[model samples]
Target: MAQIATAAPGWNRFVGVSRPIAAAILGLLALLMAWGATSDVGRDHVRVATSSSPHFDGLVGDHALYARIAQRVAAGESYYTTAAAEHRAGDYPLRPFVAVRLPTLAHIVAALGEKKAQLILLLIGGAAISAWYRRLRTEPDLPRAAAIGALFVAANLTQLAAREWIFIHEVAAGVLIALALALYRPARPWAAMAIVAAAVAIRETVLPVAMLFGLFALIDRDWRAAAGWLAIGLGFAAGLAAHVAALAAVTTPADAASQGWNGQGGWIAYLSFVQASSLLRFFAGWVGALLVPLALLGWAAWRSRLGLAALSIQLGYAMLLMMFARPANFYWAMLVTPTLFIGLVFAPAALAELARSLRGENAPNRATAV
Candidate 1:
């Protein structure tokens, strides 16, 4: 038998089981990943996002393409005109309708200017930090961890300050999603709902998150919250309908169709995308990717509504990315970035607790809903 590792009292929450069970689950995860990598499908998962291909190759890269559109829109061109022209000229697809970004972000960037828009994004980041701190500070089981929570929020958003990355729609949407998660208080859910609505307006990808919120509210019997979430979904549907109409007016039969998103890229694809989307991208590939699972473990360790919600959202996105995202869609990880890495802060305690359980030590780990 191995010696038991001691877990910090305040951070030790039952991860729904004793440590040995958690260890076994983690072990199984490792084995599955190893087995998955032995196949071409699994190997392909790490390829799209991590390929050494040039990003600004002019003919095929997205960064320069988005920057060009942002510039033209800022110069007073109609979004549809600029978008259609740019996509056609850049050889980007237009047939999927969704391939053309919604006009909300372009119009906002044009009206506010990129710098101001970036500042607003920064403010959203700050709000996420503040909201997370306030929410976690109230948790008696996570003492001294509130500041770390704020730090993680800040860390996840730090990349937003790069002006070069400002135009990526997922950047703003992801941060807003994080803030919404942090702002959610069962007693008063309006603020979070409003923020989610705004995020969905910016990026359609956020729709899934809004639906998750509605599901949680319904499960809790929080009728007001559920209705609010439902309203956001319906409003988004109307907006999308209008968007489709607008697209039809601009799109032509000759416009190119997307190559499609069914990558079936596997877990490596999901983790690679996660690495690209967060600060983890700055680290060595495998090291950065390792944090993805640890962060997931941290989320799993918490027993509260917030923990479960965050874990579910992250997992749902993981499955979507693994099953449907194209290689170039690695940036889709941004859909969960604002809230994903924050779980890393809790991972050490989780591992320690798991170790203790493996050593057959009984710790006074209680489950908390806060």
Candidate 2:
């Protein structure tokens, strides 16, 4: 186990560990990152073909299906009824109700029309970027350069929000998650909590974020925030239950059941999943994979409440993808991709700090909380 670093007399904050332990952990992490960067674990297994354009013919099948469902919903069809029909026609699985996406995004598309819905999503993405810039700028421990890099990466990701991708549930939910994470303020948690609830309504996969928020709130002994997150979780549970029941009502024995999500693809799958979903998708496999660990290291160096929370959430999802997601399920990375590259901004400073620690020097600019 690593020993926690001690703070100075007037300092209230400390970081991961003493220099030696930090060196050992950093070394191991470096080796792991290199191995993952070079390894082609799930490279051969990724189903979608890549292209210069983020949206390619390979990804259009699901988008087309979603579009059809939205059209029906807009034409006065019940969401459950339209979704079941679409699934059966497309030979998509409906056995597990979760396979049928929550009707939230479809409803939004139906109500707003695709063009307007896409506009709203882009606006949300823009807001998330602005919010992130503000959050990073204000973080006491984060270096100025790191904050700018994070903002740049975030702004770049906005370009990936192609209008055609509007129908994809993950795109909207991912932006919303980004917004929620950036919007969170210790003094005013209401907006953040509400945004998380909205994300849950869009994608069931986002439920873990709500739980994570609740856990972090409790750890910080912020009762009101914890209660709000708990309420969102409970509400999501009830909504999910109803969604499941609704699916069952329309489902028949003949409906196709999912083969299963037990991929156990391990680190390869997790890294590959992330590579395919985020801006990393635009880079070569090895180059992108290497960034994964650097980003984590950056977050580790942060040692603030927001940093810890961000790190925990990313790792939690990484574990899930490693254990459960198949190669085709790489898109699930969208759940965490909104803030994924933000860590890259801090990687250089983090590396410098590690060097300082190794030289028996105390790192400065540490903070207790965001």
The top-ranked prediction according to lDDT is 1
Can you give the lDDT of residue 291 in candidate 1?
65
The reply for model 2, stretches above 4 Å from the true place, is 1-16, 49-59, 152-156, 359-370
1-370 per-residue lDDT for model 2 (tens digits)? 0111222212112232479876886797788788887788446646752222233333456776788789899999999998998777777789877789999999999999978898888888888888888887666544344446456447445634576578778878888888888877666888989998999999988888888878878887999899898888888889989998998899999899987889898877787887777766777778766878877776665666677777888888889998888776777888787787777766655565566667788666543322
Q: Please name the candidate that would achieve the greatest TM-score relative to the true structure.
A: 2
CA lDDT for candidate 2: 0.74
Q: State each candidate's clash count.
A: 0, 0
**Whole-model Cα lDDT per candidate?**
0.75, 0.74
Indicate the worst ten consecutive residues by lDDT in candidate 2. Answer: 1-10
Model 1, span 1-370: residue lDDT tens: 0111232354446433565686786696566545434433323444432212334533236666676777788887877878888888777889888998888887887779878989998988888888888887776566554446677678778878987566778888888888889887767889889999999999998898889888888988999889999999889999999888888888899999987889887777786777777777676556654567777877877767788889999999899998998867877788788788778767766776776677777666544432
How many backbone overlaps does candidate 2 show?
A: 0
